[model samples]
Target: MIRHILLIKFLATADTAQIKHLQTLFEAMPQKVTGVLTVEWGVNNSPEYRNKGYTHSVLMTFADEAGRQNYLPHPEHLALKQVLRPLLDDIIVFDFQL
Candidate 1:
């Protein structure tokens, strides 16, 4: 399995509503894509740090690389990104072979 992790830092315009919408979009992927085993998204609830205002994240799990490859350009994902990119300040993506 592969775990595709995306850590996101939001811009000022990205508010609670945007995060909720993004989470909703991501939650749909597991059923929509063939190899997706799990899909999750959320805001940071950790109280340990100052947060640096870095707020949102998505963790996508797949059976393998091919499953991940298909997910990258999935139309629903693309459409969500159209809303995502403009509101995000920074994004870091990591793929772990598990």
Candidate 2:
């Protein structure tokens, strides 16, 4: 299995509505993409306070690397990026085998 994790920091201009939309869109990915085993996301709520301003995270489980590769260029993924790119300050993606 593969775990695809994304951490995001929103730009100042990003509003509550946009963040909610992003959350909803990301949570729906397992249904839209064939190889997506699971999709989960949430606002940062850790008390550790070491996040350096990153405020949201999305974790996706895939059957394998090929599944993740398929998802990267999928049209649905591209559409989501179009909506999110403008509002993003910074983002980090980490992938690993499980």
Candidate 3:
């Protein structure tokens, strides 16, 4: 399996409603993408407070690189990015075989 991890820092102006909307859009991805095996997301809860501004984390599992590749430009994913990209201050992504 391929584990894809994402960390996001929202812009200060994002506001609660916008963030919630983004989360809702993200939650809908599994239904839109057949290659997605699992999708889990939440606020960063580390006590260390050393996240460097990243406020949320999303973990997704895919069957392999091909599945991940298919997801990258999938229409639903692209549409979600159009909404999310502008609201983000920074984003970190890491993918690995598991």
The C-alpha TM-scores of every prediction are 0.88, 0.95, 0.94
Better candidate by lDDT, 1 or 2: 2
Best by lDDT: 2
- Candidates' lDDT values, in order? 0.85, 0.92, 0.90
Query: Residue by residue across 16-98, what tens digits does model 1's lDDT show?
Result: 88778878888988888878889888778998976676777789999999998888888877888898888889998999998
For model 3 the local lDDT of residue 87 reads 96
lDDT by residue (26-97, candidate 2, tens digit) is 888989987889989888999999999999999999998888899999998999999899999999999999
lDDT by residue for model 3 (8-28), tens = 999999999988888888888
lDDT rank, highest first? 2, 3, 1
Please state every model's RMSD to the true fold in angstroms. Answer: 1.5, 0.8, 0.9
Backbone clash count for every predicted candidate, in the order shown: 0, 0, 0
Q: Cα lDDT of model 1 overall?
A: 0.85
Model 3 TM: 0.94
Rank candidates by TM-score, best first.
2, 3, 1
